[model samples]
Target: MKYLVGVLLALIVFNASAQEEGGLKRPDIPGELMVDVGFNVWTSMPGGLERRTWSSKSIGIYYTKRKAFSSKLSFNYGIGLGLEKMSLGDSSTLASAVLDDNGTTSTDDDFVQSVLIVANPESFSKNKLATTYLDIPVEFRFHPLGTEDGEGLFIGAGGIVGLRLNAHTKWKYDNNGETVREKTSGKFNLNSFRYGYQIRAGFRGVHFFYKRYVSDVFKDPFPSGESPVMTTVGINVTGF
Candidate 1:
C-alpha cells in the first residue's frame, strides 16, 4: 500500500512537471470529463439465513480521452474516483440461561426443585447502520464516432478497485429497562476489485448508462460463504 501511494505521488509530480513545461494545450479532438451520481443495490449471493439488501448512493468524476490509433479502430481511456455508502442487514440472536435455586428461584420445601431456562433465541433490535467507501476505476472505452463532434452512442466495460474508507455499526439495546446507544467498529475488506460492463446512449455531453458487476467484491474465505452483486443505472455528463 505504501509503495502504491509512493508511485501515485511520483506520477502526479511527473505530470505536473510535464504540464508546467508545455502549458495547457486543449486538443481539437472530441472527448470529455464526466461527473456521475447513482445508487447501489447490494445483496448476498448465497442467500443467508436472512436475505439482506441495502441501498447506497455514489458519485464519480472521470476524465476521458478518445483517439483513433488506426483508421478503423479507436479507444477511450478514463480514470475516475468514486465515493459510496455501504450498509448491512439489521438482525440479532437471542438466548436464555438458567437461574440457581438456592440463591434466587429457591423454594422453602425440599419436595420439589425448580430451575429457569431460555425460550426465544432469534431476535434483533433495529438501529442506524451504514458504511463508506472510496473507489477508483480505470477503463478502456470503445465508441463508433471518429474525430468529429459527438454524434452517436458508445459502450464501456472496465475494472474498478476500491478501498474501505470508514465503517461503523450503530444500534439501540435495552439494559436494565434503559435504552443505550451501542457502536461497534466494522471491519470490511480493506480492498476490493470488480469488473463491470456498461451500456450508454446519448448525444453531446449527456448519456444514460446501466452497469453491473461481474466479479465478487468479497475476498478470501468469504466469511459469509456467499457472493454479492451490485448493479446501477445512472447518467454520465460527458461527450463520448
Candidate 2:
C-alpha cells in the first residue's frame, strides 16, 4: 500500500513539470551547435619560411543559444574548444632569445628568435606546431527574413576570446633506414590568452567565418617589425 501511494505522488509531480515546460511558449530557442574547419597561419615574421601543407589546419566546435530582442535582431553566445596546427617549412624551430648584455644600448631587449634545426633535410621531412584553446564566442545576429518560422540567413559580427590549454610540436621523417616520428611539448613561452574580432555570414545552417588575432603569439619581448599574429579563414557548420 505504501509503495503504491508513493508511485502515485511521483507521477503527479512529473506530469505537472512536463506540462509547464511543453505547454508554455518560449521566447528563446537554442541555436544549433557549430563546427568550424579551416586553415591557419601567422604573419609578421622574418622572411624565408613558408607553409607547404594543407595539413596546417584548424577546427572548432561550439554550443550556442539564441535569444531574440526583436523579430529580426537576435544575439548568440556560446563556449567552444578549438585546435590549430601550423606547419613551417623544414629547418625552423622556435628558440629562446639570444641576448647580449653589453653596455651598448643599441641591442633591443625585446623579441625572442627562431633558430634553425640543423638536421639534414633529407631525413627531416616535416615539422609542425599544434595548440589547443578554450574559446568564448559572442555575436549579434541580424536576420532580415525573420526567425518566427525558424532559421534564415544571418549576418553576425562579434569577438572571440581564447585561453590557452596546450601546445606541442610534431616532427616526422626518416632517421637511418627506419621511419621515425617525434613529439615535444612545452609552453614555448606562448601567450596564455588571446582575443580577436570576427564576422560571419550564412544561410540557415552554414556560415563562413574570418578572424584575425590582435595579440602576439608569444609572451617574449618581441622587437619592432615582427608580427606573430595568427589569422584564419573557415566555414562553420551549424544546426546539428
Judging by TM-score against the true structure, name the best candidate: 2
How do the residues 1-240 of candidate 2 rate in per-residue lDDT, one tens digit apiece?
232245348545645655554484322434556778888878754344456558788887777777779878888888877678888677655433333455232333343333323234453477777888888888888888888633788898899999998888777777677777877776756888989988889874778999888887876534434548888889987765
Q: What is the lDDT of every predicted structure here? A: 0.48, 0.70
* Per-model root-mean-square deviation over C-alphas: 12.1, 11.3
TM-score of model 1 relative to the true fold? 0.51
Q: Model 1, residue 222: displacement in angstroms? A: 5.2
What are the TM-scores, per candidate, against the unseen true structure? Answer: 0.51, 0.73
Deviation of model 2 at 170, angstroms: 0.2
Candidate 2's C-alpha lDDT?
A: 0.70
Q: Please give, for residues 1-240, the per-residue lDDT of candidate 1 as tens digits.
A: 232345458545655655535484443444466666677664553322232333455556666666555432455556655544443334431111223545353343321221111122232344433444445555444556643433455555555555555544455555566666666554433234555666555543777766676665444323346556667667777632
Q: Which candidate is the best by lDDT?
A: 2
